[model samples]
Target: MANPYQPIEAQILKTIDETPTIRTFVLKPEQDVPFLAGQFVELTVPGHGEAPFTPSSSHFERETIEVTIMKVGRATTALFGLKAGDSVGIRGPYGQRYPLESFEGKDIYLVGGGVGLAPLRSLFLSLVHEIDKYRRVFLRYGARTPEEIVYKYLIPQWEKLKKVDIDLSVDVGDKSWVRKVGVVTCLMDDIPCDETSSIAVVCGPPVMMKFVTFKLVDAGFKPENIYLSMETNMSCGLGQCGHCRLGPYFTCKDGPVLTWEQIKDIPEPFV
Candidate 1:
């Protein structure tokens, strides 16, 4: 029997560059697809091939889905040429979403870098829907340079919210830019967190993960309380394919979200 929830090919409604190398593709699926925040989908560009991408849109909306893609390799290069009305395949809303249940009445910190913010944005928007559920929410985001940052439009709105704390940074800045300058970890120094009561969700490049994890540890975040989104070259999201296997783990399956405590013994360099 065919899976009732199989992905339907969607039409591209718009493609806008969020940054120098990152672009957000707005898609209208043939049918409505609902997914929790933090899940990923497999996107196919027909003959050009496919890859995994987390939806950047809010989980509350289903009429349209947004995916932010970074031009990294051949598949992504083909993706850049996609235009409004072009057809593309989207197959999921898979994997785990941020554990909202654990965040109740606790300080929640979102640490994201570059395209990693794509997924974090979904989780953040969900949190905003029920603002009072969390005691304090902190968003710390960074990018290679000022121009490389995504979601420029939403920053002001989030900042306006009394319950949310938004801090941003850039690895390198130009004369016109004015904000914190350094890695996303730099913002950590300013946020107040309770080691046992707060949850820190981080996503970014592999090296950035290493350093940020160290900072979170030094600041007293419990190893298990620190969640992460890992990346790998994935295809055939169903664990049958070996494309994304890391030993006994499948990044597309058991996680793209895990705490350091779960995979610390894997001997794999995870992000």
Candidate 2:
């Protein structure tokens, strides 16, 4: 087994600005770091620190991985300043992956807001490879403003896929845009959420996630049937810290992706 505590070096191959405050770093690790979709890695900046981030790239492709980060604090600030060819340390593709098996024959609704789309993007990429295995895929993406939307470059391609319906909305639109204007939950009205055969995967800010959950429930999704990516202060990604604790579960060890029912008794994860 590899030393879970020691960080391995990974070189940044390229960086793409996803939004003004967000960037996606494409990395080439010295050795292959196998991981499943929805798992996260701890990345370290030599003199700065390490933080947990999910790989935005599909786990099926091991040659390289990407971490979509939003500049929010000191650690992320350092990450944002890094340029291509710079080195960073990484460890573990820790946490539970989305239950793809349970989703095999059900309709999948993917709801993401802002950078929360990172993990969902990874899952989407993995699922799309075997698109026919599922009944249908519906993506509803939201951003604070039109300028804040990430993955804008790929939506066109994703929309071209068969059996997939994709939509984008912003809390407020800009003069240059013409898409729907409203909170993400508003997108739910247009789709059918069959209680028996449809499941939803949601990720976003606390408020947004909370509202989306209520909307899904109102649309007939049972609590156990919905999955939420509740990434907290999962500092170690090794279950050694309590920062990411939710009641008795450690977000890093037991989850990152957990059914809504698993966390229903705890204080709201997003809160």
Could you list the CA RMSD of all candidates, in the order they appear?
1.7, 1.1
Residue pairs of candidate 1 with colliding backbone atoms: none
> Model 1, 64-182: lDDT tens per residue?
99998899988888999889989998887677777788889999888999999988888888888888898888899999898898988878888999789888999998897789999
Steric clashes per prediction: 0, 0
TM-score of 2: 0.97
The regions of model 1 sitting more than 4 angstroms off are 3-7
- By summed lDDT, the worst window of 10 consecutive residues in model 2 runs over 188-197
What value of lDDT does candidate 1 attain over all alpha carbons? 0.84
Q: Which 10-residue window of candidate 1 scores lowest in summed lDDT?
A: 262-271
Residues 85-181, model 2: lDDT tens digits: 9999999889988878888988899999899998899999988988888988889999999889998898899999998889889998989878889
